[model samples]
Target: MSRILVVDDERNVLTSFQHLLGKKGHEVLTAKSGEQALSLLGSNSPDLILMDIRMAGLSGLETFRQAKAIVPKVPVIMMTAYGTTDTAIEAMKLGAFEYTLKPFDIPKLTALIERALAMGQLMRTPVTYGAADADARAQRIIGKSSKMIEVYKLIGQVAPSNVTVLIRGESGTGKELVARAIYHHSQRAERPFIAVNCAAIPETLLESELFGYEKGAFTGAVARKPGKFEQASGGTILLDEVGDMSPSTQAKVLRVLQEGTCERLGGHETIRVDVRLLAATNQDLEALIRDRRFREDLYYRLHVVTITVPSLRERKEDIPLLAEYFLKRYSRELQKSGMRLSPEALERLSAYEWPGNVRELENCIKQAMVLGQGDVLMPEHLRLGQSSAVQLRSAPESLNAVRELARQHLEQAPGSAHQHLIEQVEAQLILEALMQTQGNLAQAAKLLGITRPTLREKISKYRIQRRVHLNQREG
Candidate 1:
């Protein structure tokens, strides 16, 4: 029988849990507060913990963190009321096994407890991957946030297996990095790692890119060329933005996953390739399935193992660490050594919602490194356009100041003064939004309170040019 620890501030809750768990032929230990829970943890060494989120003394989250430090592998199931649901989610990101809402069903709670204990046992078992490979893979993913720690653990668990992996996250959440980390730690680590962006390539060329055609097979087929599948033989191939694949391409990919063979474009020869498939997407595949946009079969095939990377907003505790990492990196690259972020700047970063995730933060730091005057990065040096708009809205003086500047510009211009002022304000807002969104036109449009088509039309009329970066163009 497994041993369980139940922690709650209420006496009735402790008694009820003990009675429920004891009836199941398992040992139960009870604690009324976080202090008692921690004190019992070392001596009791329970297989699972059911703790409340809100306690009088030390909070449940703090107690969980401390408990994990003492016994990292033990599973913790947080119990929270409706008001503390968000805190429960934060606990889950911080490595909690799972969470159950207050007034949870008895059967469901018992089942959850069983699953958590089983998972704890599995985690404690030795992994097949070499320690060195695991360490190296962990180093490539740079974040100590609870969410990131969960991701690292998932990578270690899934890399040794040959199953297909689907990485789902927002556009700037480093899906590609997760794929690479998996490949680096896998059994096929010595083999090549090829990445193809499905959304970036045209539908017409996607088939040819995945399955090469023979010489003289088509207009551009002057030489026999191998596709990404053949090129990534005995290795891993990351299909970035796989949700953007066309129906025909999806059919072919499904065939490859099923039969381990694919036919080249305009050729009858069926080529067999051994490659581990990793797919990444910022889209909702289920919604696409419901809409008949993405193939259900292909989705199931690629989703043998799914890893959802947390967005920057979901893991805000790591903002300072990520900011510092980017600061040191960009500083070294830009030859501006000894640069650091100020406490106020870090606070501002933590407060802002990072819609663009880690990539946007990196860009902001790089921009600060280039444009900032002093060694220490300040709040003024960071350009959080959308977030800055919030601050400006809160303080009417800032908006008035901008309006005053526009008025002055209008007064100074002679021909088409109003038109000139409007153009200037629009252009500046467009640029700032573009910068914050890393030149993503769709996101910029959303920030500017306009539709994409309208934004594109205005960009053409204003003759606006934006430099393309990694996430600059919309899928």
Candidate 2:
């Protein structure tokens, strides 16, 4: 059952909704005025809010403004005896889910309530990141690598400010988690966090989606609608895959960034917004600027602060901790809490380079939990890329893995594959050479056909240790 808040001045109106919605299996919270509703909101996490436009102490509009700051993601339906006006339109433009005239049809209102409840649930499930957040419904970004620590530091430094943050990383590297982490820590933590994927929505509709539209703006534009930027006023809006945004939308977004004001599509009124912008992308924006596909002005605006998340392969040392966390988390989720990760399974996870990063590992764990029968999650259940030990055992498999990695690099970051692959192979070769020579730099350089000075420089560049030992885990 979901929770619903019904706020009104009339005792009869509140009583009616409490009885009517309670029968529909809702935990109804009744408030006699907007002030009481705001108080209830502070103490409760209601899925849907039904409030009157006119009330004592504070008008519904004023109450809504404050309520949004408190629970921006929750859907609110405003009831008013007064018909459509600029005031009502202003309320909708400011992110009220719907404005319904009083004495609304019971069936239609119930349907609206259900829809609002679902929409709220979809967006309001807070993303738990750090260890201190204990929301059971949330997920944590588990990693303690030096690179991840740097990311945490960046989030802490920039989250408190309103500067636009550009989160750069490969797909599935948990960029959104970093964004949410920043949101959770920011001053606007109580406000909404709206994420819009520029790549997911079509270019034609992207503008209207981000900036809303007025009725009759285009074909089938039946009524006025507020865009995400307007809905996210006084909150945060994350533009994921923003590199894919069209030039027109980029200009409009640039305007918002520059002036904090935007005109809705097909509407002339300028809507001043207060939103913290966070853009995440896997694509190379600098190259896009060079190619003239992306605007340099907008790029600079977003680049005021950038947090680059390292790829999984770049931080392989964290794989054990990440994999173990996922294993335990998914076990609980899949209702197979008895299952555990085997030592060999963890080895396979660590030895393999994850192309899809944390998201792929999560899926691997969930699938293994759902499919594996015994107490242990094994290698066969993994169906993974070549792990270090396995690849070394088979030349063909090693070649295949190498080819796949190279292909991925070339596809993901064009023009970097040559140096990337060279360094990757060179690092591995250096590790093996050092192991063969017992970490003697001279002997290792001779075995690898490289000069001692060059090998030493490469080791330093790669942050590799001069001495090697087999007392601990894999190299």
Candidate 3:
């Protein structure tokens, strides 16, 4: 049994933690605020501290800094109710033992506690790459598929270091999620996690957004701003969609990454920043690098730790659990109590091809939940495009034919410019998801969490109408 400290401003939460740990046969301590928690840590230090991020006086992050001063070896687990991208990332950067969202699974938490204790026991042993303090991982990525298992093993090997990580995969393959998982599992899991999407902001403003600007640096620069890098000092920064960044901006990014510092767009001071870099992209960066679009040096820097997320279709076995997860999430979001997927609906979803990946899958379920009139989701309510019945039947049953069919499906149909761009993105996502899922719809949807009807809609919407035929050997 390990001694645990539960810190929170809310009395109910503190009590809940005490009860949970006590029931698990562990000695537990409770603190109402950061000040109280530190005082308790003066002489009696618990093996682990589970602290709430938001509090009345000194915040959890502040308390974490102080507690580590007393016992540098003791691990801290940060919990947050508000699942903001920045906060979650920040906690992970700060060397937190783990970052658990509110309303987390009890069983998962129990397992995590055991792992932490196990890791504590193993600390005396020399830690190494792919084998360092594996028990300290914030979240256990549970998967048995060859690809997913490889990803886990790789992360365990790299998580404790300060290496720059580049996560590549199709959109909805959880590239950023994988980066966050890495941050939390690393030695810097207790610092800050700051992320910026390179594609969302306009090109003209991206430079200022990343390097920050002085109060009057630009016409609309009313107040001095700190960039993501500055905010993420002593932690990690996830440069998402790195492939979309402009050449000019990419050069600047490369400089900061290589030199470990940056100067604001108009500022003179070369402010130094110590941060671990994590980059993600759905585009073919190697091609971009070859074309001189992305800097080769920067590419190599971020490539220090490369991870590819498995598409949903690739892991068919995880679909049922994923479906259940999304159903519960959508149910709570829509205020529909005890909503579920019917057995037939589940079976149908398992049969369809999800081109949109996980993001599309979640959207389909949300739309279905809203359109659904009952507690259960139905095939019709999903609005997925399943107009590929003809194409599927006509497909040839050869390896070469399957690849050719997939390729033809991605080839653009005749369309106007606006439709063409949408079609292009849609085609790309579908193809990538299919590749990752290994041509399995159930796994793809679960990977994407889309209903059969909805994924069917996109396949038709993009006119991915190439026919395919598979032998008994094909999955």
lDDT of each: 0.78, 0.80, 0.69
In model 2, which range of ten residues has the least summed lDDT?
466-475
Best by lDDT: 2
Candidate 1 regions off by >4 Å? 1-139, 386-475
Ranked by TM-score, the better of candidates 1 and 2 is 2
Comparison by lDDT, 1 against 3, better one: 1
Q: Which consecutive 10 residues in model 1 have the weakest lDDT in total?
A: 128-137
**What TM-score would each prediction reach against the true structure?**
0.54, 0.67, 0.53
Ranking of all predicted structures according to TM-score, beginning with the best and ending with the worst:
2, 1, 3
Better of 1 and 3 by TM-score: 1
RMSD of each: 26.5, 17.8, 15.5
What does the lDDT come to for candidate 1?
Answer: 0.78
lDDT preference between candidates 1 and 2, better one = 2
Candidate 3 residue-pair clash tally:
36
lDDT of 3: 0.69
Question: Which regions in candidate 3 have their CA more than 4 angstroms from the true location?
Answer: 1-143, 333-337, 373-376, 385-475
